[model samples]
Target: MRNKSRKIYSMLFLLLFLWGVLWEAESVYAANWGSVELTAEEAVLMDADTGAVLFEKNAEEKGYPASITKVLTALVVLEHTSPDEQVSFSHDAVYNVDRGSSNAQIEAGDVLTVNDCLHALLLKSANEAANALAEHVAGSREAFAEMMNEKAKELGCTGSHFQNPSGLFSEEQYTTAKDMGLIAIAAFHNEEFMKIEKDLRYTLSGLQRLPEGNILYMEHKMMLPESRFYDSRVVAGKTGYTRDSGNTLLTLAKEGDRRLVTVVLKDKSPYHYSDTSAMLNLGFQETEKQSLEDAEGFLEKIRAELVEKGTLTEETKLHFSSKVMLTLPKGETQEGISYLLLEEEAEKKEISAAEAKASDSGMPDAKDSALPHIVFLLDGRKVGEANLYREQNIRVMLSEASPKTKAAFFAVTISGFTIMIAIAVFLFGGGALYGAKNFADERKRRKKWKDRRKKRLEEMKISEEEFRILLEKRKKEKKN
Candidate 1:
């Protein structure tokens, strides 16, 4: 009873120990997504390539965009008007903007090309430039705002509405940080728009204030080389400010192999630049490109666990059908990646008897044995997935041993076979010897019995003939 109880305790202790190891390993791979202090009420950092959100604070909460609305305005105008096409400013386009707001002070009937207007809209944050572009593209500001809302919906912005193209304060003009990030991400993909936005300095010659060309510098501090907030990694940016909207800044920057888009809305002046810079630094520090070495190491560990659990044979292999170049958060190791082995789907086809026989005798498909997948998770939530399979290139190295390993394996196999053969031979030889000896002993016993019978007949003083007659008479007497 004591032995049985002790055995149960041993098994329970072993299970507990294994569970503790797995729990610790999992804990070591998860990230803490630390909070950052910022002046903006809403902010977000996103991967430009994947549009994956890396960080956010109230990103979905709607707030006034101010002049950052011009990003969408530029997008809408670029759709309809070529950069070289002439856009005429109407009386309303120049006069409808609030008196103190930023503008090029254009007069009615002033004509500027769409490219000049884009430069003014994004670089100078000119309200008149936005109105001129909107009216030229859609015939009215209201119509243009409607187009902006429609485009926002198509871009998957859930909490966004546009009341004006200039981003001027209106009860209905509101957009979330996330929505603006998405818009910037999509816009940056346009080569023409990128070309226009990336310029740090441009002179507007066709404007009514400067037919001789007025030098316009970008308000985005990060793009200026002399500004304290300038980041060499910054590729392009847009800045916004209004009495009601505070400060809003959107920036796209690249460092090493990463391209990031950061948005800060409703931050204090100058703090917008600092907040954006902080966000960009955080994005660069917290995100990393998955390395091939890390992937290989992770697969090895998974392979070992699968082998230990008997779900996978020692010779079974694993591989990715496509390259796994995901940008994941810092502290997220391959250990955070989870896998699932999908059930093998059998192929159905008519087979000839010969083909069936061949298939039954040949090696089975590797996928028939195992189907693996890599699940990408962030903050314990699944974000993406990749299928893992055993391609011909991923053949099990264990199955194909090295020269020395193969030599050792063959030697061991031969030694085992020899031992088995020797044991079989010994058993056969011993059995044969025992059978022969038993036969010889049986022959001797039969001869001795005959001799004893003869001796008995002699002792009874009976001759051969008389012995035979006596034996017959004894048989008859016994029968009677």
Candidate 2:
């Protein structure tokens, strides 16, 4: 009997040690968003549409963009010139580049269409082509660089200054990770730019062809299937390197209906690629995106309250100003999502219709902001929010617009709403989230999921006492 007691005590001690160790580990794992490690000096991960930052480290600090500036070059060229327009390479364009830099070997007076030059500029990072295209668009490289800077400012970039189109080292030429990410989002959203950059290989048919049959291949290896850093999710990207700049990378990836942009700047080779991959993983794995359209209960509550308060009219059709998305921890669920209407009586009337949810949940936890907007919450934290708009704005914009405006509006609308959102989800925090990817048949009765967890716990030699509560929550949820 004494030996049996000792063995039982030893087992309990082991379980306690395991539990303590796991708890500590989980805290650290989520300490810095799964401790997203990166060697890049500056990096950013963001939603392409809303520009919500998912991850960052010195993202606003200025760093040399190197050849990644070509993405902006491509954007400017697309905006100002047509693909069929012919561009004759001037003597200055052909020879006025940093010697030993990338070039397509085009001779002065060689004429190529803007489309071919773009392929060369993006795929080959050809310095001469960059200058040639710039000269064609704005009459001189200096003029084109000015155009580039103006466009960058217009795109909401605060820490960017452009002096050259080829991204050749210039003392004043620098951009922040945040600025580059915004530029990437704009460039990739354009259909013409998307088509040109997505091509894996292009043989320039320009009159002054390179060494005859030489082909240009995309420098970004992540999009190349055979590269070790290849990620199938990467739809478009750019790569840059220079002694001063180290390395720079910009990547845009799509998973399901979500679009993510990642920028890593001023890092060593391979790590630049690796850092981008890590940021992409961080965004896709660490966060769950919830769309406002699914929150019918919250929407109705706001509508009724607004009507009652005379803030809205009975004929005032309300919808999210845009298709707003809220990103939260992967372990969160739809019901955990709460809101506070920013109003004079907001403190008195917390709309916690779900039980004492109103009074219990500390609403208006956000910093001072504009009034008359709904502030969204999750687990007592402000995740994101949106303002209500009269529905007629969309109709008026669509109806009174010209044919071109209407077509563009429809395209933008479709592009924005292409993805679906879901109810809030909050799972027990672990290094990973265990939310079901499919909800069919209520996760197929959840039996297999439970069995899998049971087997994992058994393998660890854990008893019902340790993780039973965690597993039992699911059982109780299913019963409800």
Please tell me which predicted candidate would have the highest lDDT against the true structure: 2
Query: What are the per-residue Cα lDDT tens digits for candidate 2 across 80-104?
Result: 9999999899989988888888887
Residues 1-480 of candidate 1 have per-residue lDDT tens digits of 999999999999999999999999987755656457999999998877655677889998879998888898888888888888998998899899887999765678889899989998988898989998988988999999999998887666889999899999998999999999989887778787889877878887765666787777788888888989889989887888888888998898889878889899989987888888888888788777674336676677766765686656667676666666555767566555544432322111112222454433433433243444455556653333455554332345335434554556668889999999988886688867887888999999999999998998899888889988888999999999
Candidate 2: Cα lDDT at 475:
93
For model 1, give the RMSD to the true fold: 32.7
- TM-score of each candidate? 0.61, 0.62
Q: How many clashes (backbone N, Cα, C below 3 Å) per candidate?
A: 0, 11
TM-score of 1: 0.61
Model 1: per-residue Cα lDDT at residue 282: 81
Question: Which structure among the candidates has the greatest TM-score?
Answer: 2
Give the alpha-carbon lDDT of every model: 0.78, 0.79
